[model samples]
Target: MATTPSSAMRSLDRAFDVLGVLEDTRQPLRLSEVARRAELHVATAQRILNVLIERGYAAKEETGYVAGPAAVATAHAFLVNNRLSQVALPVLQELAATTSLTASLYVRVGHFRVLIARVQGRNPLRYQLPIGEKLPLYLGAGKALAAWLPDAELHSLIEQSAPFTRVSGEHVTAEDLAADLDQVRKAGYALSLSERAVNVTAVSAPIRHAEDVLGALSIAGPSSELTETDHTRLIGEVCRAADAIAARCP
Candidate 1:
């Protein structure tokens, strides 16, 4: 006797849900976290995680578990095949080649953003987004992505993280971030000096296909390499690349 299609589908869905929780945080998450996020009992989630770990879809770390190497490969395959990445990767490649900086494309997923495609700078010291990584709404490259979000959504995100974010030099409060978002809206780009990491800096622009905000295009490198002048110049280049990519989006 063979398993029914519905039973297989149910198993598949649970597996995907387990995988999604790991992907969303992009950090090693505890078993409780995965269970809570997946809306499954701890024992059920643990069983799924064990299977995922056995198959390399998830890994166990000191803190918890993260998406594993096989999951990374799947994300790379998606980047190679996705319409968004297909349209945007060339632009990112050229930008990285010309600027000697890391170029990245991020698309909104649920309430967060996922890195779908990226081109790396050759420099030994450079920023990296190695696929299947998710980003918060109020951080570096995320700032440009966040600018276009609706008022209610944006407010919710800010209110959630504004406390820890206030530790940084740039955003001291939700109001400060709101003001920065306003600037991102006006200037058509966003820049972060030390928002995420102390020495990594980035400039980013929005990717819009028609009326919908599709994603963001960003160039990142060491803080020293991206000077004020360099940062200003990259803003225009990033925005231009974004428009070109958006035009080709299917």
Candidate 2:
């Protein structure tokens, strides 16, 4: 019997799911483990894995299965082509200099936000996050970007990352996340107090093209230095920088 279009699509999805599970592990994964994680039958997962291995998207190791170099190349291509990072780095550097606090750029990837670039401030106590690090989408600057996503994409993200959890002592629930997003939409910016790390506070604003928000830019520092007054001032500066970056986009 011929496979229906929907069935074929589901098979394709299962193949990608196997690849995703392997990618997250960052190491070889057992076939049984991959089947369990992908929620597919063992035989079905085996068939998909075989296809991925044949195409060089995955390879078999002594321990299990691992993503091949082709996957890494694809990810690198994405970073090189990511428009937001290229356009926002100079602005982030300027913002860091002006605020004397670390400035960062984040974009959502899959279920997390990846820090693509950051500029450290001159202050000895300034906050710093390593580039290419993945952060939870509901915390810190990542949350700000997730909050401003379009309704459909936002809901999809929320559903994919449901049952919110605490990060660095900040309690978060889905309702709280929705409420915070509402506030961000109204204020045109977002702030977090030690949400992702202790003794750190951050202010982030959306970067838009025309009317669509594409990503977020944030400035972070030690709470002692980023006082209420400083927070207000940084918010204004970050917003202005974001606007300038947006205006320059083609």
Candidate 3:
């Protein structure tokens, strides 16, 4: 039987879903776990996994399955070719070195921001995330990127992501987030203390291109260490770094 276009597209989407599930994890995942995460039936996931293994996009381990060399190679291609990563690498490195804190660059993806590049400080966080990890745009440093969005879009995102719990054990309402974003816009930067992770604090500034916001740049460190530093200096450094990156970009 001839495969219909829609059927072929479905297969492609399923393949990508399976691949995304694998890539999102740091450890190997059991077939059942992968199936569950991908929202596919066990039999269907097994068939997709088998094809992925054959194509070297995934590998079967004693415990389960993991992303393979081909998947890594693909990510490497993106890193080397992505214009934003290239443009921001030097600025992020300089920012991290100057602040002695981790510097990261994020770009919006849907209602989330994905970390695309980073430079570690003298004391890197123990729980270091991979480059492609995504976090909510209404959380922590992401507010810098979210602040410049259209009012309707900004409010909608806040509405969707509100009622969040911070590491401090306090709940954040949509009104709180709206007020925070307004401050970020007025101050031209965003600051968060233990909002994304315990003991982590971040200062972020938007990277603008002409009248549009391109993304956000941030410097993060342990709350105790970062708080000891002059807040004014840290904000100045991060905002200047963000501007440098934006200037270098197209």
Compose the digit string of candidate 2's lDDT tens values, residues 1-250: 9999999999889988888788778678898999999999999999998888888898999999888778767777877997777888889888988888888887777658877778888863434455666787777787667776778978887767656555565556667778877888789888888777778888988788877767778888888766788878988998998888787777
* Candidate 2: stretches off by over 4 Å: 1-7, 26-28, 54-56, 59-62, 123-131, 152-163, 168-170
User: What is the TM-score of each predicted model, taking all chains together?
Assistant: 0.77, 0.83, 0.84
RMSD (CA, angstroms), candidate 2? 3.0
By TM-score, the better pick of 2 and 3 is 3
What's the true lDDT of residue 79 in model 3?
Answer: 82
1 or 2: which has the higher TM-score?
2
What lDDT tens digits, residue by residue, belong to model 1 across residues 113-169? 788888886753444556767777688778887888888988887788675552246
Best by TM-score: 3
Off by over 4 Å in 3: 122-127, 148-160, 227-229
Q: How many backbone clashes does every candidate have?
A: 0, 0, 0
Q: Residue 239 lDDT in model 1?
A: 88
